[model samples]
Target: MERILPSGFRFTPSPAQLIGHYLARKLCDLPIASNTINDADVYACVPAELDSRFPSLDRFQDCRYFFTWRMPLAATGARVSRKVGSGGVYKGTQSAKDVVDANGRTIGYRQSFAYFDKSGKKTEWLMEEYGIRRQVVDGTKDLVICKIYLTPTARRACDRR
Candidate 1:
């Protein structure tokens, strides 16, 4: 039996939905209907290569999302790490934003980073990584969901006539 989405279907989901629902289900080993979300160490691969590997992203011209497990940075012990890909490393801009639950309690965080080339030139590729803030027994098993997309500046540059 094949399942299909209704007409005019869109996968637009809020930050809470991504972390609280999807990411939570993933960490709990629950089954998710769509196969678009895959497990990957997003920091290990360049954005372009990572984007090409996912078949579910063929329809999206703008952004691609994935579920990744990010280890804590050794220096700061923060969720955002400075791990470099084959090309370069990812540098986060500001601190992570708090993801609050319906009861006004902080549940998770959303952090954004920019990819830089080997020459130290910043690329248009950007990634938003989301992770739960709640304490867990094994930190290594924690999974963080990330959304990778081109910056608006890059999009405009590409669309220029």
Candidate 2:
């Protein structure tokens, strides 16, 4: 994957996580499952209602568009164990809270994610929200996300980069 930087040089999370935990909380409404075929391939178990709830998914799924997938945000609640089943990527309950951005007057949110690996091991990652006052931008104003694969120790080992 190519890392897109601004013309002058700038950095920001793809999708802008605007609404932060609020959007993350929205993910809770959408179901996600690890592909039994491949652990790296996480599948969004989007129900039919989601088609109406989030029309963007349809547009993103369009192969004609370069953007073939939506921003994947997922977490399990108390029932996560029963949700993911076996051969899953991450498991455990996750929660997000919205917070104001201290750096600017614009409102922003952040989500704190906690979950366990397939081995019943605990893990956590902090995801900063990006979307607000803005919607979507091609490679320019959009938030960039790179999925880095970590070891059991949770140390970065490799990624799509």
Candidate 3:
């Protein structure tokens, strides 16, 4: 094996961890990383195919769910964006009870997205057509929120229009 620095020489967190911290600090505005984003979350974009084939997805609506919403990134123009799919996400740990429909069929998946403004205001959107609720966790300002349900074909129509 090639010789390497001993464990004592290792930095407190390691270079990789430091880089992660630095990059996250540079990229993520929120001090707390939003649970909305993950490998699974990026893979969970609406029109599932777009999430899979990105940069080359045509007929996006064919794969099912899709949404386009904006939240404050810093000022008026900056924003964090999200596109959620209609088909359920495949997280492997999600319970059937969490995703199954009342009729015992799986409808689209439910995903929540949050983005914090530079002012430290966190705005969140829940993407799903059925049974959604909101809680005022604290005395923060509420931003404009909109929710719409789209079928695969409807999404395709919106894409062309």
Candidate 4:
């Protein structure tokens, strides 16, 4: 059956829906709707440049989401590397938050990161990375789903007519 959303409606999955449905389906090799999300190595470019790279994101003016394989940092043994993008790095601001399923079982983790320039100035870019908590299959441990967006301040300013 064809699943169609209302006109002008968007697929805004909550954090739990993201992990339990979309990300889980992807990892399990299940079918997801075509073009709902695209795969990109988001760390390679600044967030501002990401929307341009993925034309599918044209519908979303304030945020864009992508699936990418994050490399584990040797220093901290974390899934996301601190150094990413051109002359910039991503800094984690808080501890990983647990994503729970309907029965309250922890299904995944979510963490936020901010982009900083070479001079250590924080930019408007923010990333929310999500990953399954289960033991991943070999060679797929670093896979993650990321949602990139402008900071609230920047988003509000940009959205203002």
The clash numbers for all candidates, in the given order, read 0, 12, 3, 0
Q: Which model is ahead, 2 or 3, in terms of lDDT?
A: 3
Q: Which residue segments of model 4 deviate by more than 4 Å?
A: 1-6, 55-61, 75-79, 134-141
Report lDDT (Cα) of residue 39, candidate 2: 15
Residue lDDT tens for model 4, 19-70:
9989989988899875566688887877778866654333455576788887
* Cα lDDT listed for each candidate: 0.76, 0.28, 0.30, 0.76
What would the per-residue lDDT of candidate 2 be over residues 1-161, giving only the tens digit for each residue? 23333344322223333244333333355432211111111223211222233322112121110111223232211121212334323332344333455454445433322334456555442222223333433322222111222232332322222
lDDT of 3 by residue, 1-161 (tens): 12234443322322232223422342344362322111223324433244344321123222212222233234443223332344332211222122343455442233333323234343221233211122323332222212222344545566789
User: Where does candidate 1 clash, by residue pair?
Assistant: none
RMSD in Å for model 2: 14.0
Q: Candidate 2: deviation at residue 18, Å? A: 3.1
Q: Which tens-of-lDDT digit does each residue in 37-85 have in candidate 1?
A: 6677887888888867764343445677888877664434444355667
- Model 4 has an lDDT value of 0.76
How does each model score on TM-score? 0.81, 0.29, 0.19, 0.83
Misplaced by over 4 Å in model 3 are: 1-98, 118-120, 123-161
